[model samples]
Target: MNEDFYIDPDIHQSYTLPASVYTQQQYFDVFKKELFLPSWQWLGGKEWSDSLYTQMPHSFLPGCVDEPLLIVRNQNQLSCLSNVCTHRAKILVESPSAKPFISCGYHGRCFSPDGRFRSMPEFEAAQDFPSSKDDLKNYPLSSWNDFYFTALQPKYDLNTILAPIHQHLSSFPYDSLRPEPNLSKTYHVRANWLAYCDNYLEGFHIPYVHPTLNKAITYEDYEVRVFDHCNVQIARCKPGQKPVPLQKGDPDFGQNIYAYYWFVYPNFMINFYHWGISVNWVLPKTTDETEIRFLTYKRNDIPDSDFADTALDLTEIEDEAVVESVQKGLMSLTYHRGRFSPTREQGVHAFHRFIYTEVFADSENIAP
Candidate 1:
């Protein structure tokens, strides 16, 4: 039987997820399969500079999963396929291009752009040739704007993960948001991926850790909303800070909304300002290390300097220092578990419950 880990539904009775979940290799291995693969992961950017969107071939979860995949756009239809050769397991596509179809560089095995197996050299002599095995395997794909996502085996509905995000910002002109290469940055943190996420899921640290951010947004009004498979923390503007004018009929109308920080389970985050969107994709590279990519997209009216990198970068530095300390402390024999703040840490508790539930879905007995 799988080792069970329980997180109480009642926040008042619950403790944080066990320290082993962050520090142990066994739990990390389990999460890679049961938690991450079943949840949709941020694959790649689909922002094309050309008139036609070309065939995009890239490795899925580059450092970790290392699954070879190709994003094929044929006649405006998009599909994701295994980039491995059917003949001898050679990688099919290595780069992005405007190719009509895929031909394995190793043996010249050919497939249609949408992954339909067309032909292969010298295979005419083979008996019972060209069955379903010859075709490239396709994964279920979903998109939000130019971004793409897919699961190895899906547990949650893609729409359920996305609908809330869209409805919240449905009134905005989404197509106007364009990618800004200069504003995008990547950083490696010497901490568990979940630790970084846990720190982000709550605003409890803003007052003490992020003084500038604390001044920009009122600490008393900050709110975190937990959804089915995601959560969002809303920040209201402080006295001198400018609030993104909330439209009438909107859920947050009459409030001074500063930023809409949304966390889509496991790793991806979409932080929306009136100026643009800051997308954070946290990738688990190892049990104790994670790589975070900060991709920014904004409307033309929003100046490059308006993105607030100063506050963002400074806040990140402070956050890293704290979470890194927590990472080191997790290794201590005395630090087994911690408690959650009922009012301020419901999001963190929600995340723990999710991890426990996903990891123990097939367990013979639940943990006490």
Candidate 2:
């Protein structure tokens, strides 16, 4: 295999990994270990906070990933717990609803809202009846502007990842923004998660792949600003076109904007428009399959009729087609890593640097 397919940092250029990275199971395994587990990802919003506070447990991943977890709100405090019974390890809280306590359907093991071991059936005869291990395992969780975030491995501090966006978005009233459920949708793409992200990191292909979107935003005025583990690409609106009004004192208040595309590390993209915000979460299913979830939250109500039919879907379809085509081409023996256009693809280059640092940093440090 041509290992040089991986981008060489020494080259100081924007280049992608060899095609095998998209097609090989070995590469996928490495990514799962080195990338996903350690990363802080956007799971769900705060809509479930009330339910959790009511002792109604909701599961994050069901059958596919099958991580049994429960969220509960008690005494004005919210907590997440492993949804496994303390007694026989039976799963707890299969469905979501308000309940006073959690009881295993199998052996009658019960836990309090805080995941403390409350009761067990027929355990009086046991010698070590009440050990600390009987309590459900709790995970670290934090909330920002009505959004709940958690991590499994939690290699880096959550604040480090969120600090930049928090500082940038401080002026906006994010807490008041209600999620528009009708605008939310998920699309399955036949490409790697990174490939989908690479497509998003730059507007290099907008003129070619997205003619309609290209018309909306001036291509020459496009600019990318990079931050730690995140990048913001400003899409300048055409002359004479009115831009979305920013919150008072916002730096970009007067600038005309077709869109503000913000990509957070690993797998989240916050796309801001005059009308509202669209949060895109990209989840990798397999080596070659990815699921992209788009959650649209309206900041300002704009008539759906004002835009073209299937506007979001068309953009997604165009993106899907191109990324899938790239995935296929990556498998060819002749194709290897390619160069990055510094002017147009700084965002993509920044992303590649992040991936390399996350995956191979330790390896590089230990090597001779």
Candidate 3:
């Protein structure tokens, strides 16, 4: 496998990322370390903040970047710390429960909720024993409204990636929206995670794959806007539907918008609809399998029936079929790569370019 892959800055001239990126085990392993480990991950909203799950033990990117982590809530503050003990590497928090501090079950090593070294039964006589090394490792955590995100080492700013959503939908009643447990679902797709994202990064397949969705949104008016760390696909609503109420002076003001499909690089999607927000977390389980978590939150003011058709489970099934087929096709020897459609696939082009840059950012002459 080549360590370097080039994606031309000009979409007209550039080719998509090679098939190996989605098919080869070597590339998959490298991506888990170079691409995902340093990228922000979405940790569900509000529930992490509730007093009920103060000491929740989370497996960071399970099956991919499998790292044990603990979400510690101290008063109103939240912290992401290494769940492993400093002494014997035992997992400190096995499950979510209300706990005042962290204690290792293997021994008597204890630490404060904030991950500070507090006590260790057998270390009193040891010199430099209760030093910084004794404390749990802390990870970076960021929030947008009620939602939370964390990273082992974030490569892009979470705020910058989420700016498009905030800028276009500032009037959105964030506080009024609450997670709907019944609406949330996990889909296991038989495809490379990137294949699912590539399918999501464009509206080119809507007409071909999602016939029901095509009728609700004007296909010709679909627009893709690429930002520093993210991209958005803006769909114009059909004649009878109500558009998102953007603040006056905004570029999208007065337009009958259907939804803003925002894709944050690496693997996170936030879709804003008439009734609420739908989040898709594309989690890579293996080179050929991905776990897609569909998390929904509904606004208190909007009736259940007002939710957009795009939010339907049928749409997800349509997407899964297309993506799974793409995954299979990528393994074919005849198809190694393809060119980007400048007008229609800018989001897909941007996504491929990001993968090239992140995977081979250290290489020289990557341009063209």
Candidate 4:
């Protein structure tokens, strides 16, 4: 492991992660185990609960983790189970179907939807038949509101990580939201996943990179509140601009809040707006390529933002262009690392610190 990428605890003195962190394939491999494997990842929203969509097959982070998983719904209770069969390691589920039970097509091995071993052919004489090891493995599944999440090995509680956001947005109606499939989309970028995230962690580039968004939000008042496993960027609307309505006793009751951008460490992002929330996952395809999935969940009980979808599309194009440029810049021999702006880039500083601690350090302490 490279100790040179050490991020100082203090923001004022901290240096950015070295270019090698993004350019090297080895570091990317390390990230798979250290950063992503144990972290909670957004799986899908309430839409998956539809009876027709049961037994959905998914591969966690595809090119990265590549763990075959099945989201099974048995009697309306959802569970995430390993899709690989214990017998001969064949993939159990290949496509989404409303199947009542799991069956391995390779050898006729069978199991329950919840991953319990049911029956197997020609194993009558086998010693200690149908042990617990014959059952499919189950991963940890969690939910916030109706959105589901799962992890190969969870390092922190999903609810605990999201608690701050819940408290901050006290009066925001969560149960009244539903997925807007037409508004959801994906973008492929020619840049390291971290590069895109680093750009998102701060509002420093909004004036230059996102001129339209800067005009809507008061950039000078932008604030980032960092927690142990997540960080939120609060963007307040400009004078005379429309702000998301807030109730009394809310955290930002008097402020003209535009949106709350919550970044769960490593990949997932949830941007809360008056109309709804845009959920994003920065999935890694390779050392230098990334796939970003944007899912829009709109509110049913309130008026929606007329321009939210357009704004999302425009901002993504601008961000993609700059991040792709940074990918090319990382390959340059002249630049290695940069410094952080203590006031404006606290979120970025905290992110680098997380990478350093989780990916490089020998200890797990995150505080400075």
Best by lDDT: 4
List per-prediction Cα lDDT, in the order shown.
0.80, 0.73, 0.86, 0.87
Q: TM per model?
A: 0.93, 0.89, 0.95, 0.95
What does candidate 4 score on TM?
0.95
Pairs with backbone N, CA or C atoms under 3 Å apart (clashes), candidate 2:
19-330, 52-73, 53-73
Q: Model 4: how far is 100 from its true place, Å?
A: 1.3
The digit string of per-residue lDDT tens for model 1 on 5-62 reads 6788899988888787788777777877777778787765536432264577766676
> What stretches of model 2 exceed 4 Å from their correct place?
1-14, 50-66, 239-242, 247-249, 300-309, 364-368
Better of 2 and 4 by lDDT: 4
Q: Choose 2 or 3, whichever is better by TM-score.
A: 3
Q: Per-residue alpha-carbon lDDT of model 2 for 1-368, expressed as tens digits?
A: 12454455543544665556667776676777677667665656655654444554544432124466777777656777887787767778767757788778898888888788998878889897688999999877777677776666778887777776666556655654667678789889988877899899989999899987877789997999887778989898886554654665566766787777889887889876666677888877787889888987765345654333266678889999999998888778888677788788888878877777777555531222
| Ranking of predictions according to lDDT | 4, 3, 1, 2
Give the 10-residue window scoring lowest on summed lDDT in candidate 4.
359-368
Model 3 over residues 58-157: C-alpha lDDT tens digits? 8778889989999998887888999999998999989887878798888889999989889988777999677899999999989899899999988778
Clashes of 1: 0
